[model samples]
Target: ENKAMESRLRQAGFPYVRTLEDFDFAFQAAISKRHIQQLTTMQWIDDAFNVFFLGPPGTGKTHLSVAIGGAAVDKGYKVRFISMDQLVSAFRTESTDPKAHRALRAIRKADLVIIDELGFLPITRTEANQFFQLVNDLYQRTSIIITSNKSFEEW
Candidate 1:
């Protein structure tokens, strides 16, 4: 009975959710009255922000990333979910052709981008630059959620 009730409550607030616990922590962290008061007083507003979820595996990094993306989608923002491998593979495949530019534009135009599994394998210098370019393009234009298993030193 308790589980069913919780499910209904989550569905009421988040209709398109894949998992009810996805935004659990973020919602809690953001809704605290103390933090809300502090945020209201802040003057500077940036065009975009990067959220890095650095932790060991099975720590809900990707889950929270997806949840944030879902919230953005619900609010009418364009969102994209691409793993590091997929992004690099696609970029490399288009590297020698005119389509490379188009691939970059897609990443740039997204309002929210969820990049999962960073530092999964060794990346070549060329691949690293391509990743950096994508990051640069979205630096101040769109929000980014990056999930990484490795520590900052590895990056």
Candidate 2:
């Protein structure tokens, strides 16, 4: 079981390991501790509900997303973590690149997908469409956790 967990963690592609216990709720007073605790139960993922962590830079959005994703992985759910840039690149090359296609396939298969650092870079119109398409494809089939520095209006 331990070996399986280690393999799942590796396949999840988390940039760093973080747990709900490691999060300092005192630092981010705006966040609801109770809500986070509820999320740790993984009920939202089971419902295939999408979660968005939107805030300015250094507000612990990525931290929270990663922590939740880690919790999901520990609960025997398949998880995948990727930056917005990386996801865009994969979408751009998925047609010509077999590796990108496989990556997208893996992402689609995951129970939870964490897209971090959105709005850190600008993408072209075509890329935006591709992103929309991917999101549409994953809709209802997979749960998504997105961490973005931009506000909903800006996005």
Candidate of highest TM-score:
2
Which residue pairs clash within candidate 2?
A: none
Question: Relative to the true structure, how large is the alpha-carbon lDDT of every model?
Answer: 0.65, 0.91
- lDDT digits (tens) for residues 1-155 of candidate 1: 55654543343233244433433555455334453233222121134767677778766667666665654555455667778887788788775766655655666787667788999877899999989988987877787778899998988
The digit string of per-residue lDDT tens for model 2 on 52-80 reads: 99988988888899899888888999999
RMSD of each: 8.6, 1.0
Stretches of candidate 1 above 4 Å error? 1-46, 95-103
- lDDT score, residue 84, model 2? 94
Candidate 1's TM-score reads 0.69
Candidate 2 TM-score over all chains jointly: 0.96
Lowest summed-lDDT stretch of 10 residues in model 2?
16-25
Q: Estimate candidate 1's alpha-carbon lDDT, on a 0 to 1 scale.
A: 0.65
